[model samples]
Target chain A: MIQKWKNHAEAYLFVTPSVILTVTLGIYPILWALRYMFYDYKGYGEAKFAGLYNIKRLFRDDYLWDAIWNTFVFASGKMILTLPVALLLAVLLNGKLRGRNLLRGIYFMPTIFSTAVMAVVFYLIFNSYNGLLNQILNMIGLPAVEWLNMQNAMLTCIIIAAWGGIGNYMLLFLAGLQGIPKDVYESAELDGATGARRFWSITIPMLGPVLNIIMMLAIMSALESYEAIMVLTGGGPSGATEVMHLYLYKLLFPVSTGETMAQDIGYGSAVAMLLALIVGVITGLYLYLSRKLNDIYS
Target chain B: MTRISGRILTWTFLLITAALLLLPIALAMLGSFKTNQELNAGSALLPKVWQLENYLYTWKEAKFSVYVWNSVIYSVGATITTVTVCSLAAYAVARRSFPGRKLLLGVYSAMMFIHMGVLTLKPAYQIMVTLGLHKSVLGLIIMMTGAGGTTFFILYAFIRSISKELDEAAMIDGASSFYIFSRIILPLCAPALGVVGLFAFRGAWNNYILPLVFTMSQPELQPITVGLANIRYGFGGAVQSHLMLTGACISMLPMLLMYILANKSFVQMNVGAIKG
Candidate 1:
């Protein structure tokens, strides 16, 4: 009995630090944010109960709505660009290609760098007047494009996002590809499925579950991404590229000179709650759809 | 002839993709060595004179040394704490049947998917301030260590895969749980711990917003990510594009080296994660 108690004590002690940190840092902040959703409080000063004013404001806020629309566009654009490319790259690389490891390393290189720093490098490359791309265009006697202007800023952001993300999704797809047994492919080949037909019929089905999960991850990450955008454009040229999180960030921590509003923690918390809801609903919907997909496969 | 053509096509396609992917990084590296004038001119792919002093300027004049030290402390501190806390928690959940075990597991799994992103940044900083830790690197490390649920789950799966016979045998020899855990299990868990440590270090090292928000008041506490952004956005007049690229290269080197050294483990870790 004493030993049993001691064992329990030992287990509890082991989990204690994690529990404390999670509650203080993870769970507590969430609750605080949730609570602050209904209150009017900045980073400083006394809190005042604003009831549903923040929520009402959120419903009517044009900037927040624009940000939401932009986020959807950005996320969808990134998804469309990244997923197919990643899948194709994974398919190409998963074979017994020579120097495939080196190829994989090169492809996955972008995933490891700081997005902020890379976005700056990209800024230098994509700068309109004297940027690398424009300079090359001028040299080639082609018209120089304004890559970071209002018209092209979102596309530029999406392109940068796709570049950073393709490697990660490719890795996920590679893992899935590796799991499909060699004999399965051989059997398919014996049955006369060849090339693209073999891939469509066998490989796609085999990768369904991983593909679903990767899609969900990719979408969630795309929606949540702001660091690259923040660095590249600071949500740019007229808030044309402002996504949901970047909007919230600007609300919470407004830059001094940009076209940001005064810090509005109350409204920002409301935005945070709304953003969380948006993410949650989309994730839940994706999970449900993926479940339906798995059922069909099974 | 068809097979030869197909193989050639595949190689051509792959080489093209690889070059396109590498172009930005290659440009950054080469551009970092060029004079500001040449870089702005943007005509030359190769630097006429390799301005090696760009690195020196970034390190000293841009105050990257301070940022690098802070990042080292933050990453190392977070990695150690995350590894320790997660390993202990994982061991408990994996080996022992305890009160709230199901609840703990449920919360952790939920937390893994519930990425609040920067939603919690404000309140997290507030909590740090309340604890009088907001201004310090230790505070940032502590807050960073909070989101280790994924690490815990990974380690839990790993520890569960480890045999229980070792624990039973250790118990039969009158070994305490802590002793078995420390002396026996920990050494065995070295690989999982190493993977987790690498991930924890990377996450902390590359983390932007949390450190950005928390260290806003204290410039000295800013990590490399924040420092790099500052040089881009907050630098008074002329954007030091060359110095910024140099800093970007400097910031990337450690992670690049780590990835090179542990290439297999880095690849395998993601594979294992997705499989789980």
Candidate 2:
């Protein structure tokens, strides 16, 4: 009994640091956000009990709704462009291709660079006036395009997002691809399965579990992304590229870009809760659907 | 003939995609060497005269010298803290089934999916402020260490995989748990620790939001990400695209080198991730 007590004590001692950090940084902040959701407060000054006032405003706020819509569009656009390309690259590179390691390294390079820094580089390249892309187009006698204009900003953001993401997902897909045993493909070949047929029948089904997890990661990441957009567009050209997180950021820490936004901590917290709910529901839904698909396959 | 054509076709597609993927980075590198005028007006891929001055100007004039140092401190500091805290907790969770272990694991898993995005940034900032550490890099380092949960899970999985006989053998010789952890388990956990360290370093280095918020009042404490953004958005009136590109290259080189050096570890880390 003494020895067991000592073991428990050691365990408690080991976990104490993590528990303190988690509670302080993770759990406490969450509760703080939850509590602040019902109060009217800025970064400074007194807190007033707003009750459901912020929630009511959240429903009516056009900008919040627009941001929510834009977030979905941006996330979906990035997903649509990223996953297939990543998977294709994974498939292409999975074989004993020449310099495949080098190729994979180059592909995954962008995932390591700072997103904000790359976005700045991208900003220069995609600049409407005298940008690298436009300069090339002009030299070839094409009309200059307003790549970051209100209409095209989201699309440009999506392309940049996709470019940054494809490599990481490709790596994920490659890992999954590797897990599908070589014999499965060999047997499929023995049964007269052609390349396309083998890929469709064997590779796709074999990758289902990995695919599900990858999709979840892709969705969460795409939705959470704002740093690139923040640097690239600042969610703008008339708030055209404003995302949910960016919206919250602007509210909480309004960048002094000649536009004075009243810092609404209460509204921002409410928006946060709603955003968390949306993410939870979507993740839950995806998990449920994936489980169903897994059942069917099994 | 079909096989030859197929090989050619595959090479063509791969090369084209690779080139497209690499174009922006290539442009940024070349643009870093070009004068502002040349970059704006000239269509040449190579600069008229390769301007080594752009880098010097960025380093000194744009205050990247300070930013780079801060970034190193932040990344290294956060990495060390995260690894230490998470590994300790991971050891406990993996080896000993103490009370509240289930609750602890459940909370962490739930936290992983919460994805509050930057919604919690304000509260986090407030917490730092309350502690009066908001202005210091140490505060940001502490706050950044909250990425512990993921690291904990990773280390937990890795530690669990380590053979139990080593611990049992050590224990039979009257080795204390701490002694076993430090001497035996830690030496064995080097690979996982390396992976976790790299990840923590990368996350901390690339982190923009927390650093941006915390260092809002303290510009000198800003990391390269925030500093680079400031050069683009906050610096003076005119856009210094050349300097920005140079700064970008400077910021990218360290991570690029690390990636090259530890390329195998990176792939191994990803594989470990999926398995976990």
Q: lDDT of candidate 1 vs native? A: 0.86
Candidate 2 segments whose C-alpha is farther than 4 A from its true place? A256-258
Which is the leading candidate under TM-score? Answer: 2
User: Which pairs clash in model 1?
Assistant: none
lDDT of 1 by residue, A1-298 (tens): 9978887888999999999888877788678778888999876789899999898999899989999999999999999998888888899998878899999999888888889879988998999979988987888899999999999999999999988988888899999999899998888879988789978988999888788788888878898999999989988889889999998888888853265488888878888888988998998999998898788878
TM-score of each: 0.97, 0.98
lDDT of 2 by residue, B1-276 (tens): 987998898889788878888999899999999998888885688898999999989899889999999999999999999999999999988899888989999998888888667766777777788899898989989978854556788899999999999999999999999999999989999999999889899989999888888887788999998899888885788778898999999988999889989998777777666676
Instruction: Tell me model 2's lDDT, rounded to 2 decimals.
Output: 0.88
Error of 1 at A73 (Å): 0.8
lDDT of 1 by residue, B1-276 (tens): 998999898888788878888899998899888888888877568999999999998899889999999999999999999999999999998999987999998888777676666767777777777889888778889988844566887888899999999999999999988899999999999998888888888889998888888887789999999898888875768877788789888888899999999987777666666765
